[model samples]
Target: MSGPRTIWRSIATGLGALALLVCAASANTASAQAPPPDIGFDQNLGAQLPLDLKFQDENGETVELKSYFGKKPVVLMPVYYKCPMLCGLELNGLVRCLRGLNMSIGMTAEKDFEILTYSIDHREKPALATQKRRQYLAAYDCPAANDGWHFLTGDEESIKKLNEVIGFRTQYDEITGQYAHAAGLVVCTPDGMLSRYLYGVEFEPKDLRLAVVESSEGKVGGLSEHILLYCFRYDPASGKYGLAIMNFLRAGGVLTLLILGTAITMMLRKERGMMESHRLLEGSTHG
Candidate 1:
């Protein structure tokens, strides 16, 4: 027994030494690597937007960010036209989700929503924005796409300020001459308050539509969506809405009770109507 114990102790000591060596090597490798991108999605939900900044639209006309606010919620995306990889993936994902929504873009439809995309690359010109818009709008191919989607460009200061409010981060890679960014979109309320955030390259249509509906504060979606809100709640860490088991159970129970009560009332009314009809028939016969 003592010999076996001594052997086990020796093995443990060796394993601990090996783990320390591996950790030291990993630290050295990390230090040698180009610093990891500072880009990521931070969920700053329910924050008020900074709408005072200025940006230029696709047509080269300067526009106030606040002008896009009011009356309808906005699906906001920060991307640069020249990005070699991640930005295109983000846009493609966004368009895919948009195609799934029956709702149109622009405030002309009370139930519709809008998309506001701005480039973080301060040096990008309006021509690039215009070109990007035309390409996407053609792909979207809806008559209302003309009015629904807007591409914007702005100076570095304005871009930084807006991104700061949304907690979106991006960094330029000096070695690669490209921008590094995470994939996500922000939804702002009709009055320009940050409402929902969705992360990743592929967004679920249900998630996208529900996010827009919530941000609109029931001004856009029907009663069904409002009912769904009762069962499903937003999850901050995952950046998606998930099921609320207890709330769902409670809602189901109440609906069942209401249905049973209505059935009983209907039966009572039918029984009373039959009795009155029978009494009237007997009285007529005796007369």
Candidate 2:
């Protein structure tokens, strides 16, 4: 009887240890799958940005957020100038996309749109912003970048307000002394209304061009661009402009009808002219 009791006790202890291990494993897996608490973006589409926020530009001159708005759509980027990895990748990717844009989109910045990048880390100063502007402008090789592209730094209050308005959430890691932030660009309307968000380090030039045109309320693009806009709509889930199949089909059908109508009208006019000429020739011969 004693030996049987001892075996049962041992079995109970082993089962308890296994249960604990399983629970720990499940918890670890969940933790790994969950996004870091500090970093993410909330798509606050149509939210009005606080244009009164002030920041020091790359030139160390204080400027109002409204100054960059009201003329052209603004491309807002939230990044720390000293970031070691993601920020640099995002900036480089943007330059590449900008270089790839078609002539209709216009390569000049302020003329077409504005690029406003402010540091998430308030500790960073205008000096770093100036340095980064130079480095990226050299890579961009665009003369207008000096005027169109801007880098800024501000106090924590202003930075936090801007971040909240744009739904750009960030977390600072004490151990690494680095910020963890989601990479994306916010396209705002000329009136400072949030219009679109393009995510990821790499972006398609077409997407950027469409975003600019869409944000500008059709003010910055050509006829072809307007047609493209009619055919494509922005998908927030994918963060890209996807073809609206129905709209494309409808546009195609309309264009086909227009072409057919024009052809038929021209054929009828030609037949009438030929008949009139035949009558004239017959009358001349009779006379």
Candidate 3:
């Protein structure tokens, strides 16, 4: 029978070997998949907006996307006000970023531009919209003078239309009781055309301002619109559009390397122990 030390070593080696195999398989799988092509900017930045949906405003007044055109630039966001997790964070991030901007929503307090958040979840009622709007407005801490922000909810047809137009794809995950949706903010020209896209939770103030100014045809100004030109591009491989890979890989590569290294170390330690044990047993037999 093997000694306790030898038995323990054997168990450790087995576990390490299993871990290594699992890691190697994962790595192979990742690499085997074709590398996604780099996504660049969409050339049709000024194309007309997609589906025209109808949603109720805070006061239950029906609001249509087409109506907003020729009025003021709009910040279009798709979110379910009742979302328990990421939605709130996304909104909070936007509110924080907007509050820090030197520019106000409207130039003369007549609602120059509007921040419209449409609830993708059709079940969401007008009351929920009001509550969410109030909650976010309170957090925003903007003076009463700034009333350009709006929260809205609509029926399925309207929601689908708006989502389709903006390329906002989302699905309900029954297991998690939550919706899986991409997070981003879109800037539309006053004439209801796609202007720019800002992906992820935290948005750059300069980018946001630039998008607004560009969408306004260089009327509003803070920074150059060139920065907003390629805020987000579409990648064919990932089957989803997002920030450039160079930026994504910078954050993802470190964690990946750490996991791979740990698996390799465990595997090497396991092999060494097995070899040492075999040598010890052979020596004892020869003696």
Candidate 4:
């Protein structure tokens, strides 16, 4: 019995040590994959964009940031045009989402919106911006995209200021001559006030549409959109609009009451018509 008990104890100790080793290995791997301190987003919701900042359009024409604002909600993306990897993915994902939208860009009659994509690296020139713009516009395959989407390049100072206002932190890697940045986009109101920050390269078309509509402040979108906005509320943490259970219930209640009222009115009108017919018949019989 003593020999068996000793053997069991030794086996238990060995298993415990193995478990500890596995846990340590996992922890190290997680730490290695963690993003560096400088590469992340500090969401600054409702921050006012610096409209006076100047940037060169894809055509090399200098334009004020304000030029893009005050007309429609702007979806601003900060990315370097020459980026070999992540920037392309972000742009492709954005184009896919835009294609999913029922509305086109720059049509005031429909759900109007604008896309402003600027290079974070000042070293990138208008030529690169032009190349990217052409590439994406071709992929989007929307006639309005030529007017609604803009690609821009700016000097270092202006770019830095814009990034700071939006709380987009990035780190430059000297070893690779590349920048590390978190993936996201900012939606601003027509008046240049930052309204929402949507995170990640992949986004839902519904999410983008709602953000644009909310930022527009009833300037765009249709009646169904208004009802949707009423039923759903944006969650800043999730960076998405979720169904507001209470609001949905309230809307349901209101609709139910409206239907009942309409039905009752119709029934009353029918009864009145029948009574009038009976009275006329009785009068004719008595005559």
Taking all chains together, each candidate's TM-score versus the true structure is 0.80, 0.84, 0.61, 0.81
**Highest lDDT model number:** 2
In the order shown, the candidates' Cα RMSDs to the true structure are: 5.0, 4.3, 25.4, 4.1
Candidate 4 clash total?
0
Q: How do the residues 1-287 of candidate 1 rate in per-residue lDDT, one tens digit apiece?
A: 99999999999999999999999999999899976779877877878887888999999999998888898888898899999888888888877776666444332222377789999999998999999998887766566556878999999999998888899888888888788788888888989999999888778777877788898888887777778788888887888899999999999999999999999999999999999999999999999
Which tens-of-lDDT digit does each residue in 101-147 have in candidate 3?
A: 63543232114467888898989988998888888877766665247
**Residue 67 accuracy (lDDT) in model 4:** 92
The CA lDDT at 132 in model 4 is 94
Give the runs in model 3 whose Cα sits over 4 Å from its true position.
1-44, 50-52, 103-112, 144-146, 222-287
Candidate 2: C-alpha RMSD after superposition:
4.3
User: How much is the lDDT of residue 37 in candidate 1?
Assistant: 71
lDDT of 2 by residue, 219-277 (tens): 89889888889999999987899999999999899999999999999999999999999
Candidate 4 TM-score, C-alpha based: 0.81
Per-candidate local distance difference test: 0.84, 0.91, 0.72, 0.87
> Candidate 1 versus the native: TM-score?
0.80
Q: Which candidate do you rate higher for TM-score, 2 or 4?
A: 2
**Cα lDDT for residue 181, model 1?**
82
What TM-score quantifies how close candidate 3 is to the native fold?
0.61
Residue 230 CA error for candidate 3 (Å)? 14
By lDDT: ranked, best first: 2, 4, 1, 3
